[model samples]
Target: MAVDVLNESNWAVEPRVFSDLGLWVMDQMKISTDCDLTIIFNEPDAMEELHLRWMNLEGPTDVMSFPMDELRPGDGTTDVEGMLGDIVLCPAVAATQAQSAGHSTIEELMLLTIHGCLHLLGFDHSDKDQEKEMFGIQRQLLLTYLAARPGELNEVIPLEISGE
Candidate 1:
């Protein structure tokens, strides 16, 4: 999987973790290794414009996904491979949600990353059953990712982002 992270926000961004989360989501969804994905961190003003233009919502949201290739999970067929499109994330919004959730901003961002990736993979939560399945899978993925990391409790893992 080739995951590209671009940060154009005022807040501190962790590109490596975003890339890792993309890869992890792809792996869990059985996407092909040749798949390419992009995650972008942008300012609230830009996000608000996108929210209004794409979703027709009034305010800036935490994350928005624009999936390309229309890739769906494999059903006794070959796995998906191609550009997975872009995920636009607003760190400012995430920070507020993090405070409300009583967690660090990075944790909240990680959750949002997983959520965006799921949307890119054709997961929807518009209905009750869909919400249950999507949220359940999100929780499972977060737990699995956390368990696999080697770090102290509540520690924000240091990430080294190269080449911006």
Candidate 2:
């Protein structure tokens, strides 16, 4: 997968980290490596505008997903691929969340990235049943990713999501 990351915020965003993680995530989802995805880091102002415009909410959110191809996790034998869509992230909001959750900002960003990808894959947590399924998958993905790439991780990031 071609994972492109753009930093438009003042925060120190590491494009490679997100790109690599995104690619791995798509692979895990049985998506073709030819797929393209974009992750953009925006400031609070831009995020707030998007939150209001898209969700009719008043505050900036940590992440928002705009899906393109409306893709789903492929069947085990299919190599699904397409323009998966964009994940707009607010690092500033994530930093505050990280602080409150007692973890590094990067960890929060990673979780958000995973959440955003799942969204692009047609996952939602609007209801309890949906939340259970989504969060469980999320937890498994994070734990597996962390275990497989300990060298890339500085520490065992505490799971901050309402994931089982």
Candidate 3:
């Protein structure tokens, strides 16, 4: 898969870190070699609009995925060089979630990036079985990535889901 990073936010996180996470997620998902992914980091206000539309919430969300179902393999619209879809992220919300979860903002942002990428690949947690499977893979991927990063220290927490 091809990965492109676009940063339009003033958040404190490093751009390289976010880009690396996007690449990491694409690798873990085993996305088709033909797929293309673009990640855009935007300010909280811009992300809030997507949060309201897709998530029905009133605040910034860490990440949101916009998958392109119209662009398929063999479609003339897909250039061998075109993107599959976009993943938008808000570093502000990621920082807050990291503070609550007791991890670095970078880690939280990476987790959200992976989650969004999975959604692009048709993974969802809208039900019990799906939630279990999706979140389980998420937690595992996050732990493995964190463990492999040099000088990174993080505590492993049990996976849990609250509310339906």
Top TM-score prediction, candidate number: 2
Q: State the lDDT of candidate 1 residue by residue for 38-57, as single tens digits.
A: 89998889999999999899
Scored by CA lDDT, what does every candidate get? 0.83, 0.87, 0.71
Could you give the C-alpha RMSD of every candidate to the true structure, in order shown?
Answer: 3.8, 5.7, 8.1
* Poorest lDDT segment (10 consecutive residues) of candidate 1: 152-161
Best by lDDT: 2
lDDT (Cα, tens digit) per residue for candidate 2, span 1-164: 39989988877666778898898889899987678899999989999999999999999999999999999998989989788999999988998998999988888899999999999999999999999999998888887988898766554343233233
The reply for model 3, stretches above 4 Å from the true place, is: 69-82, 152-164
Q: List runs of model 1 lying over 4 Å from the truth.
A: 75-78, 152-164
Rank by lDDT, highest first.
2, 1, 3
- Judging by TM-score, tell me the better candidate of 2 and 3: 2
Backbone clash pairs for candidate 2 read: 1-33
Write candidate 3's Cα lDDT for 1-164 as tens digits.
36778878775444556566666665555444346778888888999988998889988888899987533323333333235588898877877788899977767778888788778767889999999988998889888887888654333221222231
Give each model a TM-score: 0.89, 0.91, 0.75
Clashing pairs in 1: none
Candidate 2 local Cα displacement, residue 53, angstroms: 0.8
